[model samples]
Target: MKVKSFLLTALAASMTFVACDNNDNEMGQLDNTPKSVSINLSNVISTRGAGQAIKDDSKVSLADLQVFFTNGTTLYKGKTVSGTEAVHYFSTKDDFDSRDDRVFHFLPAEVNKVIVVGNNGSKITEATTYADLQKKLAIAEQQDPQKLDLYKEVELTSVEGQDDLGHPLYKANVVLEPRVSRIEIGAFKYNAIAEGTPRKYTSIEVQQVMLNNYFTTADFQVGTASTVSKEEITAASVFGIFEKAAQAGATNPVWYSDVFSADKSADPATKLQVITLGVAAQYEHAYTEGNVRPAYHFFPKDDAIGTTNHPQVLVKLIGTKSDGTKEPLYLATSTFNPAVTADFAKIYVMNFEFDDEDLDNPQKCVEVTVDVMSWDVVPVTPEF
Candidate 1:
């Protein structure tokens, strides 16, 4: 039977996170008026292998976004107006100005630097140095309220005011880099039901997405957007899946209860199961100069490790036996790689394809494939 699946591919495109007026404002002449600037948020698209780009279909909110302004010595901070908590779904776009906090007051003088923190989980209001900012991020991830979707972005840049006519224009577009990777499992199923049995292979129920040994390494600086060395990407408790039970209103969620049915003759390529690993880190691939691939320190999936197994199991599949006993199916052997981009954000696609006669044997089943990608973060180029 011929089967077609979503092949992960890489595409070339440039993007930025800043939004400013086209007016050629000159900053040489400024009065006592403050500049009116708006905050913009967008994701850096990563280059894939050969598949089309998949949109960030999930919707997120900036309710907890934190803003900071500094001049290397003094610092100013504010919590921007919280727009729709979970308004719409899209990868990147300018946030709507729906709250009173949308308007910020900045002096017409030379503003040294500006920092924007997306989804601030640590309640970080201010920071003096890069190390301080890193510490704040670590603390936030540890105490992150494992919501349905948990992702964070941080952008930092130095800026001075611009003047068009006599108006002060000081808009600093802070591009946020993703701190975590999103692993989604699609087409998950196994051949278990007997050919003539009354119980047809309808669906496979997933307990939860699990990863044995996972960790995150420091790729770029929060203050300067500079890449760090391996020595910098230390073992600082930056690994593991998001706390499942911590998710609101999720009580024993059967992640994927519905199975996909496809006509092999008509549509040779059909996906049978879809599962999302939620938030996870990609295992490190050897680092290379000028080449950006999300690489973390390799941590073997040691089931009998010093850590607890309350929520570290990557993928758990339970199949029905001929005798009607529901037993958990262990992956005899598997090959899966999570995609990591240049800036450290990721898209891990878990491909599970059942062999033609695997259902007839049921003992040996499935091959897991993983794809990784790299990307560069730039300013957004608006289209007409």
Candidate 2:
């Protein structure tokens, strides 16, 4: 009886071992190949404080977004699982992640790093290399000079988990960096003269406005040349919207007061105009040649006060003298140095107030006070 019991136990143990071996073989047959990757873009949001009265107003759209991979030396192309060129052409922000159209598959173990550039209403193609990307940027800039390019990088050194089908799943998020700096020029005309003060001027009107020493992509590494000289790039004119108000009650006459900001605390008769411009931001490292930093201005240059070069003038305000003759008043210039950061957008709000300490000499240099308002909005994620 003892020998029978021992033999029965040995037979059961053998069967159990065979069953475990079969399960191992089945598991080994499952596919563990790297198929596709999922990206989450919902974390892209503005980093500015909500309490600020004024904020940076720039629209962000993922439609026509293009992405490629780089292993620091070699570049690899990525495409959607359906074989269509990979693009995040979503019209609305809703359901950014749930959509199956966002998934892209790359070559197995080839996606070491990725660079994503945001689309500002421009078509983008697959750039297999860094040189291709620079070339593409130049073409895009020429096509849409006013539009901006937001760039971000992602590292795929780590893997998330497996998909339902048991493929190697890699997940990432693309956070954007603002490649342009925003410039907002606010002009406030102080025409109100106290009863005892001397009359300063009859009236003033804004002529042409120009930005001096503004940086473009052509001024930096993204341009055609490896190095850009200051003389190669110069100033650009910003033709702002001008509205002429008719006499007191003229028919269909637009009131200047109504066109400016809602803050009507100033005299209704005072003249004011606001114009905004978007300029490309420069990288400090790009300006540095070797160990010495060149005199190149990485920050946006503002017209310095009392500078003979005519400080960066927002508008060439033509002031009417007491004799009814029109004269030029250098009323628009600021000393504000505006810069863009990696995590947020920098907007330079310049308020120019014109005042004459000695009313007797109205033609002399008018006292111009410039107040620079800096707003840091637009959040950017850390480098992956």
Candidate 3:
């Protein structure tokens, strides 16, 4: 049954969309007007199931973790916030787990909404456009960093003559880089609901494994690369959504399933599901090179069903009508990319939407798979 129908048109330009706070709220679409919100983040490394462990396979010490919020898609003037490193103080755990505290702030009056940029690059991978780096990141995060550790070596030493390029290993260049073990993010804040129900998510956790870096000396192996095919992009490939959902119960039960799709061709076309779910939650990893400069990557609030972000994501449906002519099925779904602050930590009660077509109740179950890919333009001169 078609639940209902409404036209969706995002009045703001996402890539160039500025903060819609008080400045432009009066001039834009009413539904997506920028509203006030508070964001909070909690780092629960110890309690998370992903098993928080730093993969310092490259012999690098963690300098610090900072979360950036941006009004524009890029992470420049956007509010910059740092995540507090919480050791074993908050919870009872074995080895110390570094986590973060909460950071919530009101949207600046000049911005429409905010977006987060999880800067995970020390060497600046943001130099790559959405096309080049998206695939690179997909492949890198999937690799096992343990191969480069020091303890895994056998005692076979090839003696090299100083003049002979043979056995003598050139004063081997030792490199230590921290591969993110576990990345956790939580609710910064949200639009207060009628009842005192706890907000959707308080935190999320991701894990990584790499060779340990504590050893003073050892043979460091050369780093390898990875590959990701278009086929590799699917719901199963997405690991952040379910992880977050398990942590936070659904404020909107099928929000993920509803907003994850690429069916711009659907009869109703792809549209945004703007449930009163004024609530938005996210957890993403900004992989850093040498552990600095992050490119924001976030998980949609209900992406377990399908990945969502920047305009909602959706999976389509195919149902038989009484007449039998194929109609643009309204999965009654769409993608939502909320405007976020620069801190990358604020849980802005997202006043965002997909200015797409109208959707009604979907008739039949449509077999669809949604893959959320995040990439951006790399200008000749980067602001940062």
Candidate 4:
């Protein structure tokens, strides 16, 4: 698979920090005067895709922003030189209109590391160290696919020039990445069934699509390359599956979920747990190539955790019989390639194609093709 890259611009705000007094400094800080330092934040997405570069309308909203400072020996929460508050809140976009409003003040040495977090709420306010903040999990409800939770880490570097006061300056460009992954469902293509099939349907109308056995929470830290053992993965309470109940008179019902995990045994029945995508009724026809649905989002999943059973897509269909009767049919996609793991900031486009087959065998009736793209890029059908 060929991977493509795209740029998602974030808030163009600069943080300014000043120097403070430190007696027990290993680097031998001689300057006691306040010096200005600046830091900028940007977001870049890299994923496997075709040669098309399309832009998406997803914006980065920072309801709450927090900054942390570390110098490998000590950890400190960023605060203004005049105030004791470390966390900043912006209720509207206009709050960041003023240049002084975007500026942050923190005391640090010449060489240090800066960590920035956005929209994390008040979960990590009491966190005293960077390690404690990294272990925190961002829940599904707290995250929005449109307005993502952002995190970035950068090492501060000294700039050649200094401010008007003749104080030395330091700066760094920080790239904040989203903590969730997205999956989009494209148009469906119906194929002709083999001749002389036992059960034949005049037409098939897809009612709903879902993702089964997906994670509901992810760590705030990015690029965590460590893999958990199967026992540890099963013991964690981070997975969920969706279930739908039919209403008495409503044309479409609501979907609910519960904590779920597949059993260790390789049983096909265990793959039925799912979360509905809630596709619109007008775009539910299987034979129509123009009908497309909205994109669904979820957190990253470790491929090594479930060696045999990973996340799968489930499609609900209403098939019409030759005698004017309707029957319900369910089709599920095969397991994802274990080699291709779902990571943060990545977008997956899944196209589901179905043909008439035995209703009892749901997994074998449909063929699915997936195209992976970076977030903020328009999803397109890929050539096989």
Each prediction's Cα lDDT score? 0.30, 0.34, 0.21, 0.43
Predicted candidate 3 versus true structure: per-residue lDDT over 115-232, tens digit per residue: 3222232323342221222222231231122211111111112212321211112111111222111111111112223356443223211121111111111111211222211111
Q: For model 3, how many clashes?
A: 71
TM-score of 4: 0.61
Model 1 lDDT tens row, 1-384: 011101112111212223222232354443444333455444423322111222232222233444555545454442222422222222222333344344444422333455555444445534655345553122112111121112333232323453343343444544343443333333343432345444332333344333333332222233112221111111121111223321421454222111222333332122222232111211111212221121111111223212221012233444444455665433321223221222323334443444225433333323334444422211111010
Better by lDDT, candidate 4 or 3: 4
> Which of the numbered candidates is closest to the native, going by highest lDDT?
4
lDDT-superior candidate, 2 or 4: 4
TM-score of each: 0.42, 0.50, 0.20, 0.61
How does candidate 3 score on lDDT? 0.21
Q: Which ten residues in a row have the lowest lDDT in candidate 1?
A: 1-10
Taking the tens digit of each residue's C-alpha lDDT, what string does model 4 give over 1-384? 011111121121233333323322346455543233443333322221221222343333445566667665455654555756444444333443333634445455432776777666554556666676665443334233334567876765544445555454556666456665555554554444554554366666655555555554566675332332121111122121112212311343222111222333422222221222222322222212222233344555565423443444555666777697987666655544322355555555555555554344523333334444444432423221
Task: List residue ranges in candidate 2 displaced over 4 A.
Answer: 1-36, 43-59, 78-98, 120-126, 136-146, 157-172, 191-196, 219-311, 332-334, 337-344, 357-384
Q: Who is ahead in TM-score, 1 or 2? A: 2
- Which residue pairs in candidate 4 have backbone atoms (N, alpha carbon, C) closer than 3 angstroms, thus clashing? 3-48, 3-49, 242-274
